[model samples]
Target: MSRGPVDPRLLQLSGPTRRWTAVLAVVTALRTVALVISGIIVGRTSASVITDGTGLADHRAALGVLALLVVARTALAWVEQRYSHRAAAQATEDLRVRALTVLAHRDPRTVDRAEWRTLLTEGTEGLGPYLTGYLPALMSTALATPAVLLVVWFLDAGSAIVAVVTLPLIPVFMWLVGTLTAGRTEKKLMTLGVLSDQLLDLVTGLPTLRALGRLSAPVAEVRRLSDRHRRSTVEVLRIAFLSSMVLEFLATLSIALVAVGIGFRLLDGSMTLAAGLTVLIIIPEVYNPVRQVGTRFHDARDGIVAVDRILTLLTARSDGDTTAHPGTTGEAGGRVSEERDAQDGQGGQGLTVTFDHLSATGRDGPRPRDVTGTARPGQLTVLTGPNGAGKTTALLALLGIATDGVTGTARVTAGPGTGPRLTGTELWDRTSYLPQRPVLDTADATAVGDTSGLSLGQRQRAAVHAELDRSRTTGRDLLLLDEPTAHLDTPNARTMVEALRRRAAEGATVLIASHDPLVTAAADHHIEVRP
Candidate 1:
């Protein structure tokens, strides 16, 4: 799977935003025209005032036109600012949605939650400068630069020539600075991601750290990481400042040269005062867009890098095979078999899950390998395994939750002709899953009897009870519980298992991954997974 180029991918995702940006560009061009007209009126009026004692009353019409143009320019500038921000916001929203969709579909273990939070929040928002500042300036340069150059040319060809020749120098200097700082910018972004991850990890595990008497242990480590990130940020900023300095210097030098040429031509009586003044006024406008691009480039770099990361994730395929059938394990480009198996019965009382050559690879550890099993409805199927044996992975794979590094055939044999295999949507619709470490929101915390006041075990038990109640009301077809009894005491754990058993008796397919002897003892079918 090819990720392709970032700009095209962004454009494809944000069609409406691009249209808005184009509209913004047109408004910007109009604003530039107003500025040029105002400059021309000012130049001609000044020349008139100098040439004739009665020029003030004689040039009253031009002064009025200048005033109106100023008002129009101000109004256009306001609209441009508003529309540019709106466009940037809309584009960022699109990127966030796409990135989130990819995250939701991919295997959870493969994703770094903290980094994802940073990417979706701070990283996506970083695009504001790119869209609102950089893109607008780029479009303005494309539209305004040439128009201004032509106006200057008509007034004085020599000044126009100097403007044209020097305009390219700003972009050239920008390119040089960008080339030199690209690596540092990337490193700075990476450091930020790491810092975000570490801070999030520390916050999430604060309770555990406190309980283990190591609450303050990570403080020094965090400080060190923070300092490193600070240094990286400063380095990137320093480069940005240097780039801006170079662009400003080049633009200023070019404008000064044009000013000098126009002054000399005026002194030699080769150019009219009005024409010289107009060329002098418009020269700086020619270089303004290019210089703006260089300044905004600093802010846009992070967003660009984030887009690349997002594209990489979007293009990645699951480990099994890209072309394999949804429920089967096969090589890439393999076709889904059309032949129906004998087990492809019509809609029945319950679903039967079958796994053939079931296995999954882990990011940093070993996983279950080649494990074959069947889990029938109306029974408790307990997966017993040592730690890191992929018990949770197996359950997740059956629900199509984490299929990235999984290679297996997991068929949920239910209703109709070829056995209605479960898609991710169907699985989510029919199943109630309880993860080992659930992050509770406000409602969940309240249901769990104020999580802040409860012990971990009490909170877990309350959460389970709440979920069980929901399952009963919704009548979910399947229940996937990972380490359901992990935080509970023996008696509480037994009671929880009994409650689960009741759910299974009510015709829900219940699968649990546990290491507890009590849970395995109550299972209707027990399967042990080995590393």
Candidate 2:
């Protein structure tokens, strides 16, 4: 399949960036023109002094004009640099936002946390050199190279012909080298991602590794992976340096050919000293942009690879199934009397959750299959099962969260006059699903206690309590808790169960996945998942 252009998409995402880049490109072209003009004037003035002994006073006007052009060129260059960097910064921000949004919508089960982290943080950052340096250089080349060559052609056709003949070689060599090195560059990026994932896993599991006395083996493995990554990076750099050398050689050789032709013409009186000098000045200007682009391309290759990966992730879909919605009424039994007052016009009516032959395939373990259960409005439903019985999977499937590779009929019914049926979004709007491992931020840590000094159970209790308080305050209609008591002690577990029971009594449909007898005994309803 044909792939779409990558760089333009970045520009399309940031309108201001596109405008700024256009301005920068124009300014760069004007700066190149001014530079060539100033070089030509200097060359002619020097030639005149050497050949005719012209007084410096005679060239004062030209000197003043050259100085003005120099000043203008410098100013333009400054503006170009400013706008180009601004455009690049905006483009980077747009790409990061888009990538994060796409990842946020993706099913968590289908995503690798470490890989996504690398992609979002380090991978997105790789675009800096590409956007700010390589892209602007490419634009300058497209605009300035031909314009300078045109002036050379008018001044000295022979030199211009030499330039035109050899100028194509730089890009040709670049393409040849790029084609050869593209695959390796992509492989290097993948290797870096793998290395990052391995390191993150090792760091996250450090305590467990130390407890089992198996830390040395994993540390050694990480070192081996790090060595491999280093080798791959060095290989990429080597290719980049080699490519730079080849391009430099081609550009220099081309400029030398132009210089030799100009020298011969100057000697034979076929070209005037002034025109020869002008052609000489324009020769290097014609080739410099392309050389710079060739050098910068290597730096940009990683960003190109990252763009492709992020685009692929954005285009991909989760499971190919739709979430089901069921009918409901506000007058159902166990309805909360103060629900209207608490909600204050928000939709906080309890939902009747139903599952029929629900099933899901785990990403790495056994999943619940052919499971059937229901949690009525304003009642606490507890899901109990042995390890690996897919109890958590069942809860996730019911909430339509990370349902990739999952097939099931799970529906939510809202109260009468609330709606015809509650779709996933509507249900999710009124629902809170606390996963097995709740991610606690700094604010949560501060609210709970000193995270560094707290044990696993303490942290879990803090997160659970925070969510429980949120559910009660916000009047969320549906609460899904997975292994809420997994790290809590007996007292804390009982307290959490009582908290859930109170929310159910107050008008929320609370569904929990737990192995604790305290939680199961306190539940208004219990659904067991078998292996």
Candidate 3:
């Protein structure tokens, strides 16, 4: 249960982030070499000043080299910052797209829309500081810290011993303090989610609240949530500041131990002045990366939480999953995915899907209970039922999603010469499902941006055409549509009905989940379910 400071899942998710992190590690290693060189230059210069009484003029070459190293280090740091930020932005965008894709396919009843807004926007933004700040610091700590320690050990064994003795304290303290911050960070994120959800509800439901005379209720609740959010933020900041202080104190104390010991060794003539100075100059380098990591950990905690949220979403079970459903038959996991045989052409025969006692419970109640029917090629099977009777649910079941509360069995068998069954996802593999929400406004809707001017009926008509056209092109044997003509006029509806029948006659399984009289009347076979 104890995860590393960096989540491996994040690196796996964003290739850009991973690539940038590798770049950062390489840059940090170069910086480490530069740091050691600078330390040696300064130390030898000091030794010349004390032992041989040389002035600044005597070390001109060393000074020049130091200046060049400084410039190189500065440029490297700049590159690290620039690329790290760009990588963070790319990483955030990629992760956001991924989260959206998964959430979009998921059942609306299973996922919260308000939560999606937060996860996609605010939650993802948290990754910016994490990628740019904490991730680089982490790489630096992993690479630079060890390189410096090795250089110090090679230079002076006694100083190396001192470093070895005190080095463990920094991580020890970091671990203890980090434990405190981790809980605080999680609590803060939860409080923020609550606050965001409440504000979104208040804004969206303002009119409803006013009409119901309950505006004051949520106003008061918002105030309460705001207070909770404020307190959580303050607590997180307090823990962050305290952890930074603790880490800095440990680092400073560790450096003091090494430096003081070197100074004493120099005075006692047990160590050369050059070696002592070198050890003194290089000692802080050992602690710097660790110190930076400690401070950046707080900045990255929000991103870590966002990663957790995204992974959860990615792993959530699809509602009414056919593979997991006891009532459903066929191989598990195939209900969601399958590749139809490439041999099927657009003119190929339709596939048949048979349902027997197929039923499932919706969020509101049970629906499509005990429905039995067979949809054959060259026929339109219209499953008509009242609202809340699971017409949509039945379609989803056939598609092999949302396994919970699902019972009975649905199977897909190929029509004559439809080729191999698309069983990887089983029935869903060969099906094109048009959900009820997004109706297209034109066959070429992509050319018509800003559809705010288009009416629902226009969009609905366009959507039906688009879906049917897509199915035609893809040669999908099974087409599932939820209320395809819900927004069409009588003339349009009749045309859509004739089109459905025509498509069926051409050898495709057409199943319509609708209550429209036009659709029901055109049905070659009808199955009606009651609540």
Candidate 4:
């Protein structure tokens, strides 16, 4: 929210990153100090040899201390990298755990499972380079650049002034190039997300596509997506190249300015050899951090997108009502529950579901088109369609959850005397919809129990049994099941169909979307939806 270089929420949530970032700052500061001291010793030692007529014999202790300083700098760099990466790992783990908690409570219909999976996996992993490489570089630039500049000012005021004049140039170029580079990186991640979504959908429906002998269509689609991804990659690389060139050009010029100024002063005898050499030696330190910051800024952006995603998920919920469903209760729901309680004997008997010229269009073309059908109490309605024929879409429309584009009506009658016309979502207080897949990982909160460890047939059987028992216990007015018998054995499927028949016989409305002949043969009403 603050739009700072480091997300404040990220630091608050991840202790390791907060702790290590502080440590990295301290280590970088000490490293810069050691670097400056080494430069001074080198300059003084060289001056003693030439200007004072001295040799290595006069500077053994200084040289030894310089060697130790070099070792210290190397060790500090290692610590910086190690701690940064370690903190990154900790942050990724911490945020992912929080995201998982929120995702578990989220309504399944609101998000794409494929996309969430991608973000939690690849998106989180992308943070590695940002934390390990870019962050440390940025911290070093922030702390070391100014510190070195002040040191140069003490050693040679003229060189420091030239540096001061030229230093702002690198930042100016960085600002210009950074804006373009950031846009490029964002587009790159967006394309990657799109490609991932398409690939997951392709894999999930690959079997059906193969059965229809339409594999070539999906292959072409994949190729098209890959080309888009390639184009995005090329654009990012192009921007990266341009950014590096511009930053390099500015930094090199700034360094040259300082070096040239220092050289002139040395020749004019206005500056001592030792001070000039020291300033020259330490001047590059001023620009190196700025240069590294520009280059690594691009690297860090990939993780910025990921961090935003994680934060959004975590922000969607509070600590209460983790299992609360929108369908569970509302003013509309209270009315349905009260009516059901008063005329409890009806048990959804004599109800009617009518769709007249019903159709809905999704982001894909028409989900289902020109449908006219009815499901009455004391009868089971079965919807039959081929893969991608929009049977599921029709069910979604009935539940009043179809996204945005609505063309016609799909309504339900709640009571025997046509008491009220309600969308299934409004009547969801007494509607049981068993989707094609399990909605929640934790089954205790759902009508469909956890079937994670069960075999395919066993899973279907478990879900079907749980939903049937739940319907009977709750006296649900309508039962809508999608592929309820999928992966079910003959005996289990037969048992499930018979149970549906009994529910219809007892006066509950039953609707199913399936392709099995056994299911269709038992239906009192059958609706065929076209693609």
Off by over 4 Å in 4: 112-118, 313-484, 492-531
Q: Please give the distance, in angstroms, between residue 313's alpha carbon in candidate 2 and its true position after superposition.
A: 2.9
Which residue segments of model 1 deviate by more than 4 Å?
1-6, 112-115, 315-348, 363-366, 415-420, 423-428, 438-475, 487-495
- Please, what is the TM-score per model? 0.86, 0.86, 0.81, 0.68
- The count of backbone overlaps in candidate 1 is 0
Report, for every candidate in turn, its global Cα lDDT versus the true structure: 0.75, 0.73, 0.76, 0.75
Clashes of each: 0, 4, 13, 0
- How far off is model 3, as Cα RMSD? 4.7
Best by lDDT: 3
lDDT for each residue of candidate 1 in 344-380, tens digit (9 for 90 to 100)? 3333346667767777777664477776777788899
**Structure candidate 1, residue pairs in collision:** none
Give me the overall lDDT of model 4: 0.75
- RMSD to the native, candidate 2? 5.6
TM-score for candidate 3, residues paired by index: 0.81
Between candidates 3 and 4, the one scoring higher on TM-score is: 3
TM-score: the better of candidates 1 and 4? 1
Query: In candidate 1, residue 511 scores what lDDT?
Result: 86
